[model samples]
Target: MTSPTTPGVPPPVVDLDLGGRTALVTGAASGIGRACALRLAAAGAKVRAVDRDADGLETLAALGTEAGGAVEPQVLDLTDLDAAEAAAAGADILVNNAGLQLVRPIEAFPPDVFHTVLTVMLEAPFRLIRGALPHMYAQGWGRIVNISSVHGLRASAFKSAYVAAKHGLEGLSKTAALEGAPHGVTSVCVNPGYVRTPLVERQIADQAAAHSLPEDQVLADVLLKDSAVKRLVEPEEVAEAVLYLCTPQAAFITGTSIALDGGWTAH
Candidate 1:
């Protein structure tokens, strides 16, 4: 990669800041959501971390303190409509990041798995966004960052449920953006390619079993095959994109899907 400006000159700048915002991040106990929470808190936002795992949320709060960020942990499941509404009670920024992945051929997929994935990735986001509408409308400003995946834009074999749910969530986000635009609210979905996390790490063994390959080979040959970067994307990288969207500079940006896929979707 090369800079477009003169080699000796500094590139143009974007002053991205998220100070004085109240944020609610779902699935914030770990992975990309936790990373976003930490980043926002560091940027001086009062972050409310929401997750089902109490222990993980506590750990995230500690990490925020360690980084000198303001964060409060909340334990609840977005799958419950009332809980979803209550979680976003006073949030100006919402990051709908909770998700689940299942690896199964379509014929082998059951309704339970499909419903579970859809509920988390699609329905939950919809419920929360709908719940937060009045609050944002009252304030006349907000940012809704839907954390989707590259799978939402593109698909691979044996990920039917997850892909479907993500695709739906992307559509939902677009519609939300269109409706929220005139009200000074903006919505965008950040789609990233394969990320190295505990959930993704769990997929190694599953991939190994499904493809009849060793775990190491699954990581090397399967997941990295179409990734131009040739490495698993860091959770913090996705968080950076989320942080960017939350800034005043991105106030004009909405209703678009941003791919942080490391060229996986470029071709």
Candidate 2:
């Protein structure tokens, strides 16, 4: 008899074919969004990479060119809710990944910043989903992946705006899943812990200041303190999870969150 494959020795590899599909990814100019945009395009989908950073988008498009993937950069700020909705029109796969963060105690948090976070992370996704659903329902297939955070499931201090926005996104994702089930559409959330993104890099300073810690101590002491894995998750790793959700194998895996938090929530 052949020996059984060792558990977790070599991770399972997924092969997906998304030929002729169109995917829209927000915040596609950098970090997790950029990774997802390229990953989807590599699977033969036409990826509409949306971001406010024109230069970053150009770089992303160029990277796609090197990968022999299709990436169409769309420069638009998600704060413009109407524009966000319009951009999602005719998308077969929608990845709502655009977000901003402000690290301050609830009392010290700027009301305007909180409002902006809600607009970009929650309302914009609602509008985009609303815009994408009609075409998806007509075609009988769709995927909506929200790039949430471990914060969505749990809470942390000094991150009022981000935590609230992510929690709202979780509810929205689940509701979309229920409504879209019969229409052959699926909505899911990919919740990651501290990712090795520019956003997190910038946060180190803010977090250090907020927690009264040295910059170097922020990662291990603050970010990864509750995580079983003592490392930041790579953007490519999160992108892989996003790609898997778009695969046919994940058709039934809707209305749920796939946590890529390295056992952060296990605690």
Candidate 3:
């Protein structure tokens, strides 16, 4: 037989089959969330793509259709806690990825923005997990993947809200893992350093202003300063980690975080 591996092409990280699984991915309109949604769909899971961006959801749905994957777009703003919880019901796999950020000094940070950030990033996840747990417990098989960040493990200046929320998420994830273990469900966090996404792109301006540097210099002197890899993580890489967690081989891997931080945490 010819070589099983195609030259210059890497094989899939995991040979996972989720044929009858129903996966719910928040922020599915873009970036890591979108990558996870599509990856799950490609693996035969029926993906419910949730995002507030109707146009983006449409685009994702179209792309999913073209790839012959089942992706149903759910236009939702995760801030609406009731609806967010309701939308999560019956999901076998839940990826809590929707988030917003504001880079500012603690004293200068707007209280309203702080509240909004926690509401969307932290509270919404609590509700979503609450809704998903019943079905997961009943089925005795479920995956709860929380998209956290390196900030969850380490603190950085001018990212008060994001860091605080991520820290809280890590604790929440561990708690869920403890509770869900008896039910055969797993909860884990995937922490990436700084992924190239619209969220990071938007932060460049604020980061520049905060550090008194040119926008171009923010990536080198600021964002990647502590990263040994000296480059941004890709959304697909993070998505792959999330996918691996949902596999049977990862059944015992719970209550912890997979850090894709480019050695940021090693410091």
Candidate 4:
């Protein structure tokens, strides 16, 4: 079955060419990260797919090969800030897509989990950008796409850590844009609401339990409560936004977020 196009926003027709460019995508083993890696590779970029899940990375590599795209799998944990930074060196495009989520009230949230979320979601992106800027500055061009979320713009109960990290990411993305603009680099956030990813899938039961509802009800009433469209955003759709941001036509766009929230933020 085909998915419906976002209303009013026509499907993108821009032709992207990333020939001779190297793109580094964190958490490329699955979901939005996997989609973005494949999309960029199909556009002729040499993609470095990073993730701690070696098995998942293998699957992504095979998928890329089947699609006739160059995907080099790098098994690394994003929590290793230094390694994450080093992996981004020489990248023409950097997609900071690695993330984790925990749905718990601030009082109930584990401190370690919160720390892990911040380290991976916020600090690592900072380090990765710091590493990529030198090469990007030298070439006078680069694209940095941070996979933020609607949580960055609005708060939801029982998602303190994820919301906090995403909010911090928004600021970090803007800061990168400010610093990167002079070097011809653009930094932007792709804010998706409840993507159809493993992360969200795992949250279904957690959200159900947290909200005292069934899983299905959690999806329809809790997750989609604020979204007028009443559907989870697809990973490929988010990848397309990332692709669009990397195109020459998007050179003038920076320091802002492109919300793929199915009108969740429109509320």
Model 3 has an lDDT value of: 0.94
- Displacement of the residue 137 alpha carbon in candidate 3, Å: 0.4
The 10-residue segment with the lowest total lDDT in model 2: 2-11
Best model per lDDT: 2
What candidate 2 gets wrong by more than 4 Å, as runs, is 1-15
* lDDT by candidate, in order shown: 0.88, 0.95, 0.94, 0.93
Pairs clashing in candidate 1? none
Error of 3 at 235 (Å): 0.6
Cα lDDT of model 3 by residue, 40-89, tens digit: 99989999999999999999999899988999999999889999999999
Report residue 219 deviation for candidate 4 (angstroms): 0.6
Model 4: lDDT of residue 144? 97
Candidate 2 versus truth, CA RMSD in Å, comes to: 4.6
The residue-by-residue lDDT of candidate 1 on 65-169, one tens digit each, is 999999999998877867887778768999999987778889988889898889888988988898777888888899999999888899889889989999998
Off by over 4 Å in 1: 1-13
Candidate 4 lDDT by residue in tens digits, 151-221: 98999999888899999999999999999999999999999999999999999989988989989788888
